[model samples]
Target: MEHIKIGDEAPDFDLPGDGGTRVSLSAHRGKIVVLFFYPKDDTSGCTVEAIDFTALKPDFDAAGAVLVGLSPDGVKSHDKFKKKHALAVDLASDEDKTTLERYGVWVEKSMYGRKYMGVERTTLLIDRDGRIARIWNKVKVPGHAAEVLAAANDIG
Candidate 1:
């Protein structure tokens, strides 16, 4: 799949979210969208990233941006993770990884010399016009959400 670049229109995605809501990228067209694709729910890095984003969600909302985190876990898993962490950001379940592939986050990964397919940690900030404003790949956990929020504030 061709990797989506800055200024490219973000590929639309529709997936089941926590609380039984259907999240669609098109639904957030008029607002800045923060689409973060992570490997899984309730994992260490994923948990920290989600918590950080949730802590800054009100600021993102104030900047007219909606933060959505995506993973291959199902909605039930997402709900449990959210509840466990009291996460404030939205979490979308992408069991098939179609949207992850579209965003170029699904890739081959190796840990302990074992290789497998997984979602690479990535974040895309989309402008109000639905264009990609910024892309972060192989994301580090700390200070990442704040950086993205700053970019979103500038773009939105």
Candidate 2:
């Protein structure tokens, strides 16, 4: 797992996305990129986080930022989740976990004394130059999207 920090160039990825589209970090050059990695699609926390980001999509757009929600879920699941919630943000699928590992969000998690591998609920703000501006790890759903928007606005 790579430990990416502020000022580090974000690892670029091209993955299948909802609506039969492909998402790539490099494709949004010259724009702030918000890449939110969640554990799964349609889960409670993930759903809230996705909706929150979706709600703030216009603000993010006005700030010259592009938002993408990523998980290990397949494109089919992503399509369903987006349609079910009417999400405005793009949802990328890292079915093989390659992108997840590159971002260092895939990890071993313990729940009820059971060990499992899952996403760490991380969000990264990539500057227009492709360098990381901010990173939120172990993200809490409440107000997280707004916080990220503020950060994006700050950097712009």
Candidate 3:
């Protein structure tokens, strides 16, 4: 599938999220949505990113945006991570890789000179009208949540 671009309607999906609830893109239609995909839970980079997003929840809320983190991890893993970090934002489990494929973040990766398939840390800021406002692909965790918050603040 072609990657979503700015001005394109963000693809919608309803998937199981932390706390055993389903979260859908359309559910946040009237709000800016920050859809971020990460590789795993509790890993160094992923944990840092998640905590950063959690720390910026109020800023994002003030900017009228909701932060949603996606990963191939199951509900149990999400629960553990959220509980461990006391995360304020929603964490969605995409174990089936369905949503990941639709967004086109799942891809081939290389490490230790070996190739594998994994998620490319990416974030998409969807405007209140459902159009994608910006995309941060191959994300660098440092200061990323703040960057996203700034973008969301500028959308209006």
Candidate 4:
């Protein structure tokens, strides 16, 4: 698995989002993109992260940034989860894990001595030029959204 480094051109990918709309990084060129990847939808940590990001949507927008969360879940799952939480952030479905793999967020995780492949909570900040500005890997959910927001706001 090749992990992308900062300054690399943000990989362009199109995936189905909550409303059956195809979300693509290329489409958002010349715009700051805040892309976060979580292990699953509706889970405790993921829920907190999603809600936090949603709460800061206005601030992100004011800073000219787009926020998107992606997971290895289907569109239907994303729809239910967003509706359940009244989330305003865009959620993309990556059931085939193609985008996740491309971004290098999918990896082996272990719990209680058991190992399994899963999404490693990660976040990437892509500048308006479509190059990666920052990356947060194995993210800690608490205060994460705010941190990312601060970074986005600094994108001048």
Among these predictions, the greatest lDDT belongs to 2
Selected candidate, larger lDDT, 2 vs 3: 2
Highest-scoring model, TM-score: 2
Candidate 4 lDDT over 1-156, as tens digits, reads: 678999999889999999788889988898899999998888999999999999999999999999999999999999999999999988988899999999999899999999999999999999999999999998999999999999998984
Per-residue alpha-carbon lDDT of model 1 for 1-156, expressed as tens digits? 668889999989889999999999999989999999999898999999999999999899899999899999999999999999999888898898888888888899999999999999999899999999888989999999999989988876
Models 1 onward score TM values of 0.97, 0.99, 0.98, 0.98
Q: What lDDT score belongs to each candidate, Candidate 1 first?
A: 0.92, 0.95, 0.93, 0.93
**Per-residue C-alpha lDDT of model 2 across residues 80-118, encoded as one tens digit per residue:** 999999999999999999999998999999999999999
**TM-score, cand. 1 vs. native:** 0.97
**Which residue pairs in model 4 clash with each other?**
none
- Residues 118-145, model 3: lDDT tens digits: 9999999999999988999999999999
RMSD of candidate 1 to true structure, Å: 0.8
**Global lDDT for candidate 1?**
0.92
Backbone clashes, candidate 3: 0
Which segments of candidate 3 are over 4 A away from where they belong? none
TM-score of 2: 0.99
Per the 3 Å backbone cut-off, how many clashing residue pairs does candidate 2 have? 0
Q: Model 1 shows how many backbone clashes?
A: 0
